[model samples]
Target chain A: MQKQWLWAALAWAFAQSAAATPTGDVNAQLAEMQARITQLQAAYEARIAALEEKLAAATAPAAASAAAVPAATLPAPSRGGGAGAFNPEVSLILQGAYQHKKKVAERQLSGFWTPGDAHADSHAHGGDRRGFNLDHTELVLAANIDSTFRGQATLALLDDQVELEEAWFQTLGLGQGLGLKAGRFFSGIGYLNEQHPHQWDFYDQPLMYKALFGAHSYTQDGVQLKWVAPTDVFVELGVEAGRGQNFPATEQDHNGAGSRALFARIGDDWGVAHSWRVGVSHLRTTARDRERHMESELIGEHAVAAFSGKSRIWLADFVYKWAPNGNPKDRNFKFQAEYFRRQEDGRLAAADEQGLALGESGYATRQSGYYLQGVYQFTPHWRAGLRYDRLQSGRQDLGSNPAALQTVDYRPRRATAMVDYSFSEYSRLRLQLARDRSMQGLTDHQVTLQYIMSLGSHGAHKF
Target chain B: MRRFWLVCLMLVLSAPVLAGVKVLATVPEWGALAREIGGARVDVFIATHALQDPHRIEARPALIARARAARLLIATGADLEVGWLPILLRESGNPHIQPGQPGYLEAARYVVLRDVPQQVDRAMGDVHPDGDPHFHLDPRNIPPVARALAARLMQVDPDGSATYQANLDAFLLRWQAALRRWEAEGARLAGLPVLQVHRAFGYLFHWLGMQSRGELEPKPGIEPTSGHLARIVERQRAAPARLIVRAAYQSDAAARWVAERAGIPLVVLPYTVGGSPDAGDLFGLFDATLARLQGALR
Candidate 1:
């Protein structure tokens, strides 16, 4: 028996070595030995188990009862359904930047109504903390909640506060090309508005977005219904109803929704290598007391202007992407442009730092802005981009409060050029230079170096 | 006008019966396989062509639209389409083809995978936890995948069960005979050492009894750096490889650099169907690959 066992052991070792090394013809030999080893090992294990059971019975009759008592009281084994088994996909995005800018008196959009937060560009980490800055660090978690729904949440960690940027659940398999989403999410009014800052081609938002949507672009706590047409050409339509509680609109008291939006998109492949999309969207909301920041000789040092009434915005966006043979790894070019026009008819109230009312007026204005940008990935790792932003103040009719709700003659415009390098798909570094004339009479030349890194789950980007 | 209306009505009436199961395949190889099994009973739409890297694909609206209409979705799986497939499935809004459903078929699940990692780490350069997803290169792996696909097709389109079974049997016969021919032709390539640009052809090397010297890249998915190439060249000088091989989709620059420095011929294999002019289908893909390897070795 000992000799046979030794032979079996030797065979097992040989088979293991054979398995470890890649030997083409020896596969058959290894398999035969593996079979013999399995038989010997199973037979020996069965014998050992039988012997152990007999020994246990002989040693102590009370041992079985004791084991049974604990077994009965123990919690039932998990059916592979628990928090430990279900791991949600988690991703953390870290962004930081260094800025060098030419000094300007006050950072404000010249031709449009600037929000109180306008001086602090959304890209700036903490209120334009000039030199080195830590941008928004985002923690994102996403998972299929069940068979019917999938949920995602994004938490933005700022220097001083942690904000829930997006928390929403979307229907997964809603048939007939229909999907429903509810909770707080970015409003899909424009292409760039839906994309987060880290996904932007440039380091900063366009002058149009900055002047119109304030520091944080439009986000709504609402419900959205979208339908994609079952056709060869891509066609999508969506509508949203939300509580108008952010910038463009202030918090409202009524239970009814304060904001509504309608959007439609259509796109198609031009060829094997090119694709394009065009979309139009409209958002309408009521502003209770939307505050704007202004500093003019008329209102003195610190002036607060509040506008309350109807706010309506219309946006048209177009995107064209080209990749040779539809493979973007080597090289690709993307051209994107959006035109935004806003009309606000409201009552404007101006108050100084001392809470003294300067003036009140019926404000009516037609303002429009557009941005054109092109990003080219010259190689697998390097990309260069150029963008131009222009905003026009069509007509501002401040009935009784002309001095309070002011509109400048200058047009807000900015030109930016940037080059970014991706070390891998998860990490990127960018250097950007821009000439900004958004501030009435001031032209600021800005240089920014930024880095973005992603950890954990890989997020899919929507085109 | 009356005749035109009558013809339109007749065409519309016949559409459902004539139209087969709509199948969306994520890659050209799977697309070709779906065609072989599904035949005319299925209309296969390939989401990506052979020229594109299967690992990276944009979830384009065009793909989503196609997915929306597809009754069945086929993927290589084993995380090959992990980057974009989930997003496409979510956006497609097609309930029938969602995961764990009858209409969803992951080909890798049916085949025995190679190079399954003991531990997964991204630092290993995009290593798949399940295994290398390039198993289609080994022709022996095709039968099981084909069988699973036939089963899936039958399940999704019960009316075409007879056709799917017959097509699968016919495909297996052709595939078995072709495998024998490939094995005979590949006999001369046994024990030949080759440098691979990536692990894309790991199964092919194992199938043909060829030996791998090393990879051009420092790690999988990572591009070859000058230092890495120099190291590969230095190692090749010590233990020489016969040839340098790269997939047609991969750029030849790095492989060429290593080949020139190490004094070996560089061969670009058609990694999948339609990857090269000669490799128009599954059979052609293997035939072209074997021909190129044999030519380079000779």
Candidate 2:
């Protein structure tokens, strides 16, 4: 029995050893499989890294070349790069108008003798003539001169003359909320004074502007200093010292500063939809030997008058804008009004047809005028506006000669209505109709069809 | 002598408090993001309100004053604020924030843009040749912009690099978790067709897997003609969009018109941080957007 048990135990031991062999083999197979997986993962990762590197290398030069290529096909590159790298922002504005008006041999404001209307060269400066007319062509060039300065030049081409509308260099990085501008520029006397003709809401100048500042508003060679206050509401104060070469001041030899102006403006937002701005401005200038030409109906000849004196003008302006929740894409409304009062203390010398002095007299005149207009954007691309202008002659005094000049009724008024359609922001077509009683005892009916097109790069207008 | 000494002391004491970097952001969303990254190290000023259309803004003296004082200017770029910002910058005379300077940060540079036109023409209606300027709507696009912004902050204010990195990391952590939650919650929104008033929501729709079926405007800035509206109506009838979407700053007239005709609900999404009452901050902006979208789906 002992020998049989030993043999059975040995068989059991043999069976256990045989079972352990396969289990060890299974564990070895599992370890091998795990090692193969890790090796495969590393290999795949290296391949991916190599492929990515190759792809990047292949695209790098192509991307660089693509970036270097100029996008000239695009309209008006805003940045200083590409094909027109050296070119400034150049924009050409073409304005043309066709008007129908009654035949008036001479166009003149009776009591107000202004410098802008003194030139009898052509019908371009007076008003829209009786046919298709090239109102003006404005060529604007604006660029950054350097890190410290930016320059802009606007040349206006009329029928018979070329006028430099604005040429100035504005300072950059002067700090302390202060800005300085030097050269010939429009004075910031009123809301509309600083804006160009193309930016006007109405087709014609207001009666107040025509009577107070002459046909064109005040543009003079000047240096301006402006300071903006650090406040929640917008507040700005500006002062200008100019050479009085334009209207309101016709100082022939302006070796020194002959014109000075001061203005203050404040603006704020009422809510998301409404905003308003109000401003007050004052201008003072001295005129010496200023020539003005007038047609004498009684003598059937032209008379030249030379005046010398002090001119002071005061202006107050207000503008309010409302857009539905500040989105003006669909509809908006703007109402603007400006009032001006002028006082001129000077002497007038009239010359006869034979180059003889007919009379020399001291005269003082006080006049005030105002215009209010409202523009409504009735649709996305259509707008309509209505304006009313009126003038009041305050007082006139001819020093000693009472019979030399008759007291003429000088209260002038006009009403204008206009509708415009904009094909885009750069182009618009307008139709304007007005009844002008600017001249005493004469009511002139005028109709105008105008079109304005902007050719190249144009910066956005300031509010 | 005492009064002079007192004034001097006041000026000396006030100098340090005012020494922080002044940053100006064109929109409220950029202001919020700048605040998050800048924390206590910067003072941020937002130029335009959320309710105001960024395309047009008045060149107010207050804006010029703030711009004049700002050391850093952050804008969405791509000519989104082309109308007023150029004038403001020129008038401010602040060299630090001028283009090509280190202090100027354009958020659009870091993200891949959409709707880049092949040819730029006004007939195309004010298309931005650089692409769509409204890329901030996508949550995923924020990380790269934030990273770039952090790098710029480090370059501008190297002394605060560590703090900026920490802030950015923390923001990314929270943002990643939020993104995961949003993705899960918005998974059902995939394949849902929608209509938009403008192409402003392209990035958001792309991220959410929502399909844009049509747009209200025939072109980018052009008003839709009657024929275009008729075509949109016909297309909607064929495919049937679930909702019509518009932004808070956009006029709702066209969207309402299309929605009423198509028999779909109109949803006004907060396009920026402060665009809606519920969208008070960055997180709230996304939360409110998702809620509105989900509500529309329901």
Candidate 3:
């Protein structure tokens, strides 16, 4: 039995050794396969590198040839530093108009003395001149002052007279959604108040704007603070304190606050194609030595008055826009309207050529006006617009001066229709026709053909 | 007093959890890429929708609000957003995202731009002097832009560097693999003649080695005059193209007008993420684009 056990153990050992030898052979085969894969990978990488080199070589020549081609007429990209680097983006807008009206007469609104009533000064009123006119030329210069401030200045040339339109410096990086703007700026009271004349959709200002703000919108030297809330819906609040030297208020010495305004706006998108915004604004100012000349029926002569007191104006505005699928390239529509009510309480002192005040009496006046317009872009380059304006003068008491209180029809309205073709965003040709009944009894048919062209870099307008 | 202190402590503790770098992108495609590269480290906001044209945008107050809070701003920036971006930057009052700042990243600076005009006159209908700003159509251009964006991201948020680098490395691997697959599949598309609506697809055509037969628009923004259309139709009769291509945001009337007359199919490619139902994200965007092109093969 001992001899048999020894033989079996030897056989088992032989079997185990034989199995281990095959395992070693399998390991050798696996190593060979792994080495083959590594070699193939190296070869593949080498081929890729060669192809990449070839691609680089091919593209280098093409890029060189392209760069060698001169692009003298092309405006260089606006970068931080280069020759003329500190020079601001300068843009000049030229506006010319040819006007043909049925009657060329003194323009007057009879009922309530409008802020921009017929003034003898040519600069005080717009649209009064007839025939070919170089309406206005606007020159704008804007640049970053440093990393912390941006400055913009605009000069408007009207009838060969240069007027400082706007000059402002705005702060940058004042966190917490706060922004500060100082210097002369257009007051943000209504939708169109801040827009320059070159950006207006029509050739003439709305009748209501003409009545309240004079042909030019209210601009003042002021400091403004604005805040935007962090929310899903857009909400903004702004306040301004200014030196009142514009239409509603006469020029005054810098003493206390002359004008102050507060405004709030909220906006949101309805869908992919529609957006709307609504805002309410309130403005208050003290008018000191406000002057106006009227043909007094009592004396049948030109009489002058200087009034001093307070004026408060409230404005509400809404805007709606629709573009198919949020793309305005083909078709879009914009509708906007603003309503304003003014309350004036003051005393008027009439002077008869002499420096002596004939009489001083207290008077109160209430007036309101609104304008609604819609512009439709039927195609990429063509647009048509229509606007309706109406004004209502409420009760006006001339302080017991029966002859001075001339009661003519107090309602004035106007309708305007325009069609414009934009060659590009910077150039447009507009033809406008209007029936103006702004004067009491006269109906004027007015036609204007205007062209606006812009040169150089101009910043984009806001929504 | 103890209760008030406890509440304040809780608030302070939770502030860091909610605090992340805010990034604002002008278009949805850039927003998607930002989300990918800035994973878990950023809050991304897109200024314009996929269906909106990049050439023009309203400076809406909501966009201004977003710009005010953003720590980083990424734009295509060969003047692609010139119509509104400058005003938005001025209004935002955020100096960090202004030009020449570390927080501003213009993707066009990293890629080789195409179709730079020799002369820039308005007579050419609003041509970009810096060349075509649509360079992201080529997948190969994404890497350099991605690297630059990664560097900017690090500069903006150094605490998240490792996370951003790891994410970028992974993304590069996947993007490279996908690029290879696309190249293999697109090999048959080389030298194909095609018609385009605008110069928007110059990079794509250059990548696929396709030849541009003609354009639907006479110039970039100008409509095709009848005379131009007649000439194009006459030319197509002699040398026909395989198909007509347009981006989702472009007007289809002109493309359809020419395609019908020339007897070629019209294909509207999803130019960016969210442009089509099938293009849900970056991967899906390229997949849908390739599939559409392949399906249009003659």
Interface RMSD of 2: 8.5
Looking at chain B only, the TM-scores across the models are 0.96, 0.94, 0.96
| TM-score ranking of the models | 3, 1, 2
**Against the hidden reference, what TM-scores do the models get?**
0.86, 0.84, 0.87
lDDT against the true structure, per candidate, is: 0.82, 0.77, 0.79
Per-residue alpha-carbon lDDT of candidate 3 for residues B69-125, written as tens digits (9 for 90 to 100): 788899998889999888778777677788877788787765667888888787787
| DockQ of model 2 vs. true complex | 0.21
Give the runs in model 1 whose Cα sits over 4 Å from its true position: A1-85, A104-106, A117-127, A293-303, A351-360, A402-405, B1-10
lDDT, model 3: 0.79
Candidate 2 local lDDT, A1-463, one digit each (tens): 3335544765575556557677577666556645765565456544543443343233311111111111111111133247766678999999988888888876656567655443632322326368887777899999988878889999988856788889999987676667899999988889988888788887777877777666456786989998767655777899999988666777567477899999999887786778888999999998876776655443456666667888999999999988877667678899999998889898877776566776778878888889999999988899999999888877877576422544455878889999999988889999999999888778999998888899877887877
Q: Give DockQ for candidates 1 onward, in order.
A: 0.21, 0.21, 0.26
Model 3 / residue A169 / CA error / Å? 1.8
Give fnat for candidates 1, 2 and onward, in order. 0.40, 0.32, 0.37
| DockQ result, candidate 3 | 0.26
For each of the candidates, the C-alpha root-mean-square deviation to the true structure, in angstroms, is 12.4, 12.3, 10.9
lDDT of 3 at A359: 65
